[model samples]
Target: MRKTCLDMVYELAKADDRIVFIGSDLGAGTLSEMQKNMPERFFMEGVSEANIIGMAAGLAMDGFIPYVNTISTFITRRCYEQIAIDLCLHNLPVKLIANGGGLVYAPLGPTHLAIEDIAIMRSLPNMNIVSPSDAEEMKRFMNQSKEIKGPVYIRLAKGGDEIVSDPKNGFKFGESILIKDVGEVLIVSSGITTKEAIYASEELSKEGIKAGVLHMHTIKPFDYKSIIKYSQKVKLIVSVEEHIKNNGLGSAIGDVLNDNCYHKMPKLIKLGIPDQFPDKYGTQEDLLKYYSLDSKSIYESVLGFIKSKGLKAA
Candidate 1:
């Protein structure tokens, strides 16, 4: 997914002279082709994330669309003030390509983990958040980013994830994809977690529990339209995300249901990492399984949540 995003950036730069590439403290040979092709527009600076934000903002003001790449934790947490003030506040056309989002860096411990990046960026107005399901969707999202106004935070998952998104369904920003249509319960998810949601939905169906999956790739402009439409069709709504329960997809969906659904809101259940730092060092999948983010665990949790509401499985 990471490679596809950068490749798309390079492709976009080829046709658009106004496009620029900037990286803060990235490894060697990162986007080397773009650097070789457009040395004047490509920049790779040392570990100053804050300075890069200001630089991107200035470049944007000069009619250049700068795509900034860096570790998720550093770009969002380290230079949050600059991001909020310079990029979002001014509504610059800077694209933030966040590397190793969620537990992708779990082996490096909690310090490198950006489990709350979406929450941090979602708070800022004019900031668009997107977590594509796979590399194919990343390509589609990046193609749209050029025309999308305001700052964009593109959360990248580990490379080589399964491609679950289809071009036929259409990838629209701030829109939701109805993966399996509305059923007894709806599974709303984004990012790589959507893969798990799809898996759990299929498994649940085999056991006579009709489950529907809704993949919300765009988080920030929070697809309130789809959330309300799908939430009304099911008896229970289950939100799954790789982020924490607080200030993440779950919280955002709850706010929507309360404000829009009123008492007509269905029973909503949020599944995600608890509000605690990951102290264990392991692979990304291992950490997710430990936190009950795996397919089996999610299926069980959703099924359990359904039965607990005195509802039938089928």
Candidate 2:
């Protein structure tokens, strides 16, 4: 998804002179082509994330759509004040392209893990939070960000996921996509974790437990209607994400369920990173397994929860 977003951005920038790319010590060989094509537009500010964001905001004010690229943790956590005050307060159309979202940077330790970026960024006023499920979704998302009037935060994965959304359908702002049929269990998920949820659902189906999956590509301005309708049909409602339990997709959906007070509401389960920071360093897959966020772990958790409801213990 990050690669796709970068390609799309470079293509758009080449065609449109008003577009520029800004990087915070991430202008590796991956972006060499873009720099070669538009040297004046591409600037690599070494590790000064706050300055980069401020520069993007200023560029936005001048009618240039500045795309700021960096790791999820540094992009949001290190430059919160600049994003909130400079870009958001003035409603600048600065596109924040962040990589290593969720546990994508697990080997780099807790400081690099971006579990809290979504929760924190989504809370800011006039900040549009977008986490497209795949590269195709990201293409549509990047195009749509240009049309939007306020600041937009686009969280991209490390790539290598099969496209689940149709390009012809296009992406609508503040909307959710229903990927599969309705089932007894509804898995409402965002980002790459949505893929994990789908695999877990398929595994559960083989065991005679049909599961429905909803890919929540848009995190902020979530589709509450879809959530409510699905919540009524399923016996279990599980929200899976690559982010922390607090202020993430799970918490957002839970808020809607609680507010509506829908009768016979399905049991809500939040599957994500827990409160504590993991001390050990490993690969993204290792961290997911360690935190019980993998497909097998998710399957077991969901199955165990369902069994617990029936007073069955193995």
Point to the candidate with the largest lDDT: 1
Estimated TM-score per prediction? 0.98, 0.93
Please, what are the lDDT tens digits per residue for candidate 1 over residues 211-247? 8899999998999998898878888888888988889
In model 2, the Cα lDDT at residue 190 comes to: 83
Question: What is the Cα-based lDDT of residue 238 in candidate 2?
Answer: 84
Q: Write the per-residue lDDT of candidate 2 for residues 1-314, one digit (tens) a residue.
A: 88899888898887788889998888467678888978999888888998998899888899999988899999988889999999989999899999999888877888888889999998998888888889988888877777778888898888787776777657898888777666778888888777888889889888777778888888877788898888888878888888889999999889889987467678889988887776778788888888788889888877887777773321
Question: How far does residue 296 in candidate 2 sit from its true spot (Å)?
Answer: 1.3
Runs of candidate 2 with Cα error greater than 4 angstroms are: 162-170, 310-314
Clashing pairs in 1: none
Q: In terms of TM-score, how similar is model 2 to the real structure?
A: 0.93
TM-score of 1: 0.98
